[model samples]
Target: MLLDHFDYEKLLVPLNLFYDLHTGGPRRPIFHDVAATRPELLELDRNFSAIREEVLNVLPERASIPRYHELDAMQTYISGTVDKDRDWKVFPLNLMGVKPKGFADRCPRTVAILDTIPGLFEAFFSILEGGKSIPAHEGPYRGYLRYHLGLVVPEENPPSIRLKDQVYTWKEGESILFDDSWDHEVYNSCTQDRVILIVDIRRPMPQPFDAVNRAAQAIMKPIYGGQIARKLATMTPPATDGDAPAMAEEKQTDDKEKASEELAKKLPDQADPVQEWGQREATGKAPATAGHSAHGDKKPDAPE
Candidate 1:
């Protein structure tokens, strides 16, 4: 069952808060230091064509690929029923630090490139269906920074993400990096799916804290065990009666379309309030919090 996470894991809250307050990096909407990464992330850059090729191979099998929340319960709010018509799927290479056994072999060239990057925390290909809109939400920890290398993007009215006040549209082969701590939302308004290579890397911190952050991140592997289990089992083995299953899937799509219409009527515009809150927090008018509004839930939970 999909779980809408509304609170932070109790034990990890303090540590997450500590890093958010004392981290050495600049606090901004978008990060501009890709070259600062250890080893320069050139491996990913060099294998762009091969990586995109692998993603294109996976694209045709979107039905078999799991939805984001199906893999990680914590992601249910954005990848939940509210965006039913706009399916958000993922093809994961790694979650936290654990690599799914035999899974990387399917995308050998991409995995080989990923292996070269230092402090690699999470790596996956985010596949957003046409007209999908991920509600306003954020990751709690500042220990990691999110990176995206656009692979398959539609040229006409390309997909865009609003991080704070700035909206960035994805361009094929372009890279975008930012801290996910601030409330951000994504939308694929074009009537074409958008695919991007999403990776999370450890944020560079000073001395002992840097080491401490790495040790703390290890705890997330066990925490996200459910997601890993689902990812490992995502590929559907062909059954003898394939047509029946295909019909069932078609019905599911119809149900999703109905659900999305109802969801829109219930969930209010998240941008207005979240943006106001972000502005207040920046000026000390409001206290910073991991929780952000999503799907009309009681309180939003911290995401990875």
Candidate 2:
């Protein structure tokens, strides 16, 4: 569809180009070095066991957890499988700023740990079934950085993610962040499941562009995020929230710029094929418009 292609060219691509100016141009290798920034989230690592148990609470119904494509059909090309039960899976905590009232409330500690992260965007548990591989691809947007904290890393033949030419393995309780726009993919060589806590936070930028990213998010969240929230609610009945349905029904009384934000989310599958940006998504460009409500005045909705 012309619209799908448009998602690549106009709606988001230009905003992505803006990232190069501050992020040291695209030539730099992927995977950011963040040992200094590590201390803040150490609590998440210290309490890793409890977080895993919280996730384990929902593991019995793994089949019911939404696969990447289930959340955003555009990902079918990369996420694969028509059944939705097999391959790479995701259980969103906060997607595109909308919290799933039931699913998120189940893991109080995990939510609390995640809430502390700065510039938080999307937060979720990424579960990869044994011997699965997510096709090689780049995240659709460049506005936010991606972080992964290993929760259940199988020791033998464990899962590893490929960012550019390097292949990095996840170790229990350790974490790392990287620019997702760089080409990347995942592989799980073992027969055991590999689960990691995945999140995206707004990338730091100089002045005006930083605000541009937020402005874009504010416009699109209501429009594009609703489609994602609604689809996810249906896939996992238990995760459904009353607010999810109303997302599609909410009135957008804001200005045209705000309405433009909705456009990005409305046909989000076309926005960016990879990444979730809600995966309306932890997906796409224009420096990723917005993830959730403002951080300073955070209403405590829980999309962190």
**CA RMSD for every model?**
18.2, 19.3
Query: lDDT tens string, model 2, 1-304?
Result: 2232224325577788776777766575476544443344555656767777778767656766877877877788778853244578888887667777667887788888877776666889988888887778878778778877777777788888888777788776667778778888887668888888888877767788889888776655654566667776666444333443354244322333354566666866565422323224222232111221112211112111
Model 1, span 1-304: residue lDDT tens = 3422323356456776677556543464355456554334545655667788777765655676778887777688889866686689888787766666544556778887788777888898998988998888877677788887777788788878888766778766667667877778986679988888988888887867788788877756555644465556755622223354576578666765665566556666544433333344222232211221111111112222
Model 2 regions more than 4 Å off: 1-10, 35-40, 81-85, 238-304
Ten contiguous residues minimizing lDDT sum, candidate 2: 295-304
Q: After superposition, how far is residue 78 of candidate 1 from its true place, in Å?
A: 0.5
TM-score for each model: 0.71, 0.71
Off by over 4 Å in 1: 1-8, 24-29, 225-227, 234-304
Backbone steric clashes in candidate 2, count: 20
User: What global local distance difference test value does model 2 have?
Assistant: 0.67
